[model samples]
Target: MGLSILGLSRFQFAMTTIYHFFFIPVSIGLALAVAIMETMYAVNKKLVYLKMAKFWGKIFLLSFAVGVVTGIIQEFQFGMNWSNYSRFMGDIFGAPLAIEALLAFFMESTFIGVWMFTWDRFKPGVHAIFIWLTWLGSTLSAIWILAANSFMQHPTGFEINKATGHVRLRSFMDVVANPQLWRAFPHVIFAAVMTGGMIILGMSAFAMLHKRTQQHDGDKVFFTKSIRFGAVVALVGAVFATGAGDLQTQFIIEDQPMKFAATEAIYNDTSDPAPWAVVSLINEEDKTANSIEIPYMLSLLSYHSTSGSVKGMNTVNKELHEQYDAKFGKDMNYYVPVTTLFWSFRFMALSAAIAGLASILALWFTRKGKDTLMNYRWLLWIMGACTFVPFIGTTGGWLITELGRYPWIVYGLLTIADGVSPTATVPSLLFTNIVYFLLFLLLGAVMIFYSRRVLYQGPDGEGELPAGKARAAERTSPVSAQSTGSVSGNAGGTERSVALS
Candidate 1:
């Protein structure tokens, strides 16, 4: 790979997007789940359930803080590294993102504060209302961002600015009504939900393990329910991800055939019985794939019918299309990462399938009317696996979707070459990237440590410690004597919660 500012920008873009998404998906999914759990607890008047909701909400708060911090970098990168691409597509792209800021982000930021501190001050009914609103805000925040991204993935109805030489908005309705928005939005939300389920399962597993082995029955009762709840969500969300993901995949294949062909490394114009590239260890120079493939899979998937021709990269791209006809005109440096995208996409899909089945089985065993408590070992195993599956699936899915786009920053509207900073060379960009990457790594580490601290201090719905404990503990700095009262069984059984507040 030759070094170029565009290439470095791609790497930087990839790194930042991956990091931002890591937090956003989990926050969206977990926030919804937290709201639902709290609502159920409020109606049922179950203290344990309420306690469980409070515990998970603490973790959600941690993830939300990190999500917002990292997300700001995404908007910044557009101007800093991808200025030209932004200038070209901003008129079109900025519309939804701007709306996202005003409508969704503002709602999320404002009410989250209202929800957070109101627990002690407000009535349960009022607080629940705020919690529901918080969930609504997060969902809308995701929707608007996805709308902006979907437009980039598949540009739709827009007019050009003759004066500015940039694509401009003709109608707001067209931007909102873009067909890609319908496909991309649901897929991303479902993925977010899946990511949330994983975290729930993973944390609950740790809690379960801690409780069961040590015989902390108080925590186990709530955490076990948490595991069951997480499993159900994971199973459903994984299926949702798959269904929505396939829809977009099919759309991409049908509409962007050359894009699809290049994604699969089909160089020659081959007709009839389109062979699927499965598990190819390809030599780029020779263009030979020495790997196995199940024949006819691609044909069935793309067309919903077998025995049809799927054109290769060279044949379709070489055609002398009407440059005057393609509304924006076809001018692009043809690029594709057939091997990387193909495998990454498959890995993501396959992992989701595994996670879904595992979760379903776990849910089945868990919901067996108290009998499931006998086979606690299986929940423990599945819970451990559930925690990491979403990460793998998300990372893989992103690699497929983002890398598959190859040299385009804005689908057909802009190329990666045009997006590079004119004054900066590859080395300069690389230097900046190294600095950014290291800073990001440090930031992520601090966030994780802070999250762990938050989890340790919270999960208690009833203010367990005395009100004065915080002040006394702060003055002493990480060391506190036992309460003035006699030591009870509670102290022996439960570890002290280190309050972040």
Candidate 2:
């Protein structure tokens, strides 16, 4: 086995995937938030809620657009760089991807277009329904994608075809019901919601600060409500994310013991009650490390009992060799990069903790009696800066998940070494890597620029109505009679009604 083509392919895939994820969580989170705001508008007929929905909707649309463009490349790479793996899993893996496109993507895109154009054509309640449908589509899309990935982590309901050297699906229901899918799906969804909430909270903080300096109460109520909403959603998401992460860890310990051992830097088997390592200096060569240990915590976490035994890397590796060496004709090392996994896990945990705490503070300060909370400018600044915390946590969690899998592309079925395309060459892969890197960089830059511009504009009247509908609104509401001629125009013309055509 050589590192030539295989290593470069892994690098390229990781770079694209990480970049792609930067937009996905935000899109998913914002979609749900937008739907809630629109629903409020539908129920109360308040123009402020409509303005809120429109402002956040602009950001969501940009994220969804860029995410879709970048995601297309992932499918292509599966064929171009990892053809062998594609061939092997095609029978079982292709089904979910196909379903995502047919059932979710089309539905999301179609409703988004209708929602965008029908702003003045449909009644407010009907318009809200369109946005809700779009949100449903986006949520369904995530479920399908995660379902496909969970199969790779803990494969289920598949049988090998001896004649053709492929795995075929035996039960679609089993694939959808995989325990790992349920564990991972909620974590990803809540994290995405947290990401969206942070973005809204941060941007709202900036707007509030900017408005406060001007002594403007024109949009004060609007942005203030947004801050409270974002904070509450973020707090709930953080709490759920922590619970889901704990469940995921228990699943990991059960299904991939070697990965669990590697994550904790465990080298040698210990007694029935194992201590959890808090911090460690790993010495891979000597298979020993200096560490702080929390007595019985690992056993408690792994089995809910302090007396349960947890095997370490040394013992697990020996067992794996004895069981598979002759059958696979190779010596397998079960250890992953211990230091990287250790730090990534800690960073992810710490970030989630910070998000939770910050959200609590934000919510408390923004409450009615705690109007004094806004007087502290530094708190607002901190809340604004926390926008990136969920992104960092998300990236770290994925790194730990994918990298911890190490040699296997599909657990217990196919090794990454056996998965790369036979025609892949170091030179070809390196050139393509540069091309893809530059292409995505340009796309990412464009997405950032557009998002910033929209954020600064503050969703006043942009895209609120089509040209024809705007003309119709102009005729129906005489400019001479009202201060502003637009639909649901506010006192200072800074806010507009979000009525759909």
Candidate 3:
């Protein structure tokens, strides 16, 4: 059967949101990486760091451009496909989104241009400030956006307006200070860092493989340092992402028990020392799942103890039905998509673990100016192939976040059906969906094409080095070149001109 209006609208939103989100982390990650690389160049006055900053900055620009285009479309979706949601959430959402636009987006956009064009105008340390500000603006943008989303996950700082029957903001501070927002904010930030780090690490590995064949000693030094830098960033991000994820899970156990239960595929109430499911064959129709269990792990996961029992989906469902059915009325299925959440949670966890593992291996192998990584061609190939690993985890994590809150667009406040625009038709949704898919496909292809083109060109290639002054710096010592800001600026100017063109 064809999808109904609700189904099609939801699908379209889901697909578009996911696609938009895919680039967001990459932009955020690359921005911070570029900022740090530039800062290192400013501090140590190393031309190698300058080369890294310039090369990666191009990738960041591409990602940021696509992210902006996709994000603009997302804003329109609220009014076009989910007008009711907009009406209900207008008051609560307006402040943060406005702040994001007026303060964060403006700050980011303004400084990014300054950073790009003024590379030749400012001193190294002074020039680095612009990219740092750009990172701050982007991070702040995420914070405000997540504050609005957190309200949907766990409604706070709002009251029902009796006259309009819509939610109005009660305290802006409370909304921004939401516990859920903080939990989710750090998790997302760290994940983005990991995503960007993986990209750098993977690209470096790919370059190393090619550079070895061509016997380019300069390129070898560039990629080697880059690989180590990427490894450190990725490892730190993975560690923190995992920790932040655990905190989110703990919060979920308290604030959204149904979601926790669904993730574990638990149907029946468990004993005091509940076993954690390793894998489950979920039968949603029968409200049953045959799970491969780890003794006392569920208790540990839920309560951080091996003794306490947690409510299962069946129990949570019964309680929710009793609480909400009276107001919303009858046949309310409280059970979420068990199979989806179960695997999504696992995939997200596995992604983090893999990132952590790869990073540690990278660090160990390349310790103390060692060229051990060159010995493992297989490992380099694998690292290059695993560029998309963190993306998989991030996508799966979002799926669990959105889907686990089934039937409700806003927890305990609005149903998905009520939030969807009642006037939206299947035909319009289908047409938009097709258009979005094609548009995203084109953007993705362009991004990949340009990124590959950059890699193929190599770091020492044309436009990477400017004419007279940059060549003069190459002959001078690294420390001596610190005083030669004009020479370095010319190189940066060349990169900016190439990237922008």
The numbered model that scores best in TM-score is 3
- Residue 412's lDDT in candidate 2: 72
Candidate 1 lDDT over 1-501, as tens digits, reads: 447766677777777778777777788888888887868766876766566666677778777776666666655677677778768877776677667667776777777777765565665566677768877877776666666666667767777788987888787787788787788778878887877777887766655554332354555566667777887778778899989988987787766666677556676754577777777676556554555657888778777778877776666555524332264346643546767766777778877887787677656766756536435767576667667778777877677666666555666666567766566677777887888788789878977786555444434321223668755543432111111111011000000100000
Cα TM-score per model: 0.84, 0.88, 0.91
Please tell me which predicted candidate would have the highest lDDT against the true structure: 3
How does each model score on lDDT? 0.66, 0.76, 0.81
Model 3 / residue 178 / CA error / Å:
1.1
Clashing pairs in 3: none
Q: What's the residue-level lDDT of 176 in candidate 1?
A: 81
True-structure lDDT of candidate 3: 0.81
Better of 1 and 3 by TM-score: 3
Model 1, residue pairs in steric clash: none
- Give a tens-digit lDDT track for model 2, residues 1-501: 235788888887888788778878887789889889878878997777777777787778777777777677765788778889889888887787778778887778778877765676787788888878887877788788777778888889899999988899999999999998899988988988888888888777776666432254545666677888888888888888988998999889878877888878888887779888889999988888788999998888777886877778898788777876775556777677788788888888888788888888877877886655558789888887888888889888888888778767887788887888898889988898899999998998887787665554444532235677656544553211221222221110000000000
Better of 2 and 3 by TM-score: 3
What are the clash counts of all predictions, listed in order?
A: 0, 8, 0
Please estimate how well model 2 matches the true structure, expressed as its whole-model Cα lDDT.
0.76
